[model samples]
Target: MTPSTSTNLTRIVKFGKKPAKRDARNLKLSAILKAPPRLPAEYDFDVQHNGIPTPMFGNDYHGDCVIAGRAHQTLRFEDAEQKKILPITETDVLKEWHLENGGTEDGVYVLDSIKLWRTKGWKAAGKVYKIKAFAEIDRKNHDEVKSTVYADIGTGLGFSLPDSAMTEFNAGKPWALTTKPPNKKNGHYVYVPGYTKIGPVCVTWGRKQQMNWAFFDKYCDEAYAMIDAADTKKKKSILDGKKIDEFLTKLKK
Candidate 1:
């Protein structure tokens, strides 16, 4: 298959993820989930439920992909672990985006968004949701990316997208590595809840989008594994067996 030929389709969708940021205080995934079990060749937590619809969360009209990614991940996590979907609305996402971007359409840094997610939390369905913690993942490490999805830790990804991606997305095709260079100015964010033999699948623009491993390696610049507070409360969480409680305690020191 050839790359999309439409160079003028850059504005087809809104990309709200700002350039990647490095924070020294961020925890490493390896340090938290040590000696992770071998992962299955394929795993997916973004299973379609009977009535749930994949939401765009205001991403279509606003540059809130970062905030939208958070909502998508929350939906996937709650559906898989709690067996119930939280009513996260577009208004909730736009509200958070307004707070993060200072009431502007300007994008937000991935690290800053996750930090707020942990400390302040996002409000949805009359309930406030917060993550226990978030760990930085090596974007280039395919195994680590797959393992994170396999463990039910929803992965948030930031990418320096190539212009051709817009055309591919418009055509409902999986994102693939192209000879075209990545545009750093076009940073976007998405939530990855599963992986197939072809590669990791992400939710963006209110739909399930697939990307091959090469596309992921070429474009993904920042990655994170979020530990949901609700999952921690349920002892059945895969993380419960990993002794995350002890790890978090040590982190507080």
Candidate 2:
């Protein structure tokens, strides 16, 4: 029996893979792992923008939060008027980049993942997975570029959560995170498509999770604003010819 198109449409997301490495910068972010990070009280504002509609994906057994977040950014950007926002296959993230060391059940790396995007691109879901890639969305400081980037491009925000692993574990929602995961083992990452009634709506595990304005303000340490390639004139790739080795050297301490 042939699988219905609708059944295939729901297969965009998969279980998350664990984080690959723990870097000094990430550890620093994790050190301040108190629940409900302190922030200004009056700043109870929420903002939202456009994004692709991806479903709640699970890592199942692997720790691939990095890939999951990247998938969110990639799929949402690629989501054109298709029935599904992110129409892709599991092999895209799982199998394609084996020889180049593109993926791992252990985890995904920020710079390494960039290399994968540059080298192999990504697999688009259809009758068969199609090769597709997007222009690099320059990594800019949220404070410096947030004004220009937010509500514009769907991007990635890297931050560490408090002791809310259990919260995330049960609810399948991740909010207030950092590049350096707070737990010391997991460097959690999420896709920030846009804001909500009170705060930014984060994407993970098929859920468009929204966090409190204060929580987002305090834990959001590092942010990378991503725009669809066609949306901005920044056509040139930011990570041109850069090697992941350089980032690895810095991550290891």
Candidate 3:
């Protein structure tokens, strides 16, 4: 169903994030980075570069938020660290979604998506992109979330969304805690590449969305830090040498 904004513009949004899955072998952010750096009180990765406007990546018509979120994170990581924007297209995203989700419009579990990202990788612009590793984040720790963005580590969030979020999103307003109950059936995923003092800034439906910390804590059920292979090649300090080796070793098992 489409939701109308104050301007009477119809906004079509599709949510495809399933509830988070757990595995005992999954790496934890706390275990990887013992002490993260102190970051500025407010920071935004989007402002660091002049990339093109965010794309919906077919999210407007399909339940491909998982793949769309990956595409968004790839754009941000390439622009910020590689100094170039990857030409990711809607077709490219949908192709990956089909492969990962078995050609279904049904949603995906965040863990399964990340595993595919690390193993099979995704193809965009005729090039394959892969992440070196991924670790679960403490979604309740506001400071940890901020630090991940500041450090240039890509972050993906999976959350149960409340119905009122559609109105707030259509109005281009920050998502805040509301009395409305969250609907797990509306599980959605977004890539958060930046944050301001108010809260994390996520890319969804081709727009930059800001959500307060309270709202994040309330609805954000799963969070992860994706270490891009390029970042590792550049020696980005997502993990020290010893820790990265240990982490990779664990993943191999």
Candidate 4:
């Protein structure tokens, strides 16, 4: 496929809802449909380093292959009393699931307890994980409430695609139009195709913490010493679990 050829992209549209045994399961379904006519041209850069080029339909420069645009998506769910909309990133979704299902609640939710047990009479191959957390204020019996649930399965965190997903993405991975504005937390910035100053959000992880030596050797040492000289001095958790209190106490001597 050439960059100029038109390609089809799927979109989900919710029509109605269906019955489910669980109240949460009784949710709406979205039908995957073809996008509307007169869509914007999609454009992605083909520049690559030493890695092998990703799979593509045709020449990398075709407008038909590119679907460059902005998208603003909002996720809504009922929280006992009212609808709650949480704007989250792809990573935030995983964190949210862990918060909702795991014993250790996130900043928003507080963990109550967790139980783990085997099902078989003897040596069972799998174990069950059960967890409970504090309910929202609007939930029934909010002050005195408890829920027991189980997931009879194996759960683990794994990694794939050794290289960056951005590399694959820029190599003409067909995507949807996004209206989300770029934020500084995304790390890097780039101007949009038509919108002169509008930039997109992009971030990467797995980096080591580095200190600012020049600034560290400046105004901080004296003030730090004075603070450490106090009677109620306590250790601080620094990089890689190093403590500052012990070091400071020794320095004061």
For all candidates, the clash counts are 0, 28, 0, 16
- The CA lDDT at 15 in model 3 is 85
TM-score of each: 0.87, 0.54, 0.91, 0.16
Instruction: For model 3, state the Cα shift of residue 93 in Å.
Output: 0.3
Question: How well does candidate 3 match the true structure in TM-score terms?
Answer: 0.91
Model 3 C-alpha lDDT per residue in residues 1-253, reported as the tens digit of each score: 2211112367887888888798877887777674666678888778877654699898888888889999988887777666888888999999998897778777888899899899888898788988888888888788778777877778899988887788899888999956788887778999998888899999999899999988898888899988875244323454555676687886678
Residue by residue across 1-253, what tens digits does model 4's lDDT show? 1111112242111100011112221111111011212222321111111121122211122111110000001111111112332222333323333333342221111111111111111111121111111111111211110110001011110011112223323443311223233221111111111100111111112111111222112211110000111111111111111222343244348
- What does the lDDT come to for candidate 3? 0.81
lDDT of 3 at 193: 80
The lDDT of model 1 is: 0.79
lDDT of each: 0.79, 0.43, 0.81, 0.16
Clashing pairs in 3: none
- Tens digit per residue, CA lDDT, model 2, 33-107: 122222322221122224445544344334455566766666654543242455554555445433224444444
- Tens-place lDDT per residue, model 1, 77-194, is 6776677888889999999889988887688999999998988998876778888888889876788788788777779999989988887888879999578899877789999988
Error of 3 at 63 (Å): 0.7
With candidate 1 superimposed using the best TM-score fit, by how many Å does residue 168's alpha carbon deviate from the native? 0.8
Return the lDDT, model 3, position 132. Answer: 84
lDDT, model 4, position 45: 18
All candidates in order of TM-score, best leading? 3, 1, 2, 4
Model 2 lDDT-worst window of ten: 1-10
Query: Which of candidates 2 and 3 reaches a greater lDDT?
Result: 3
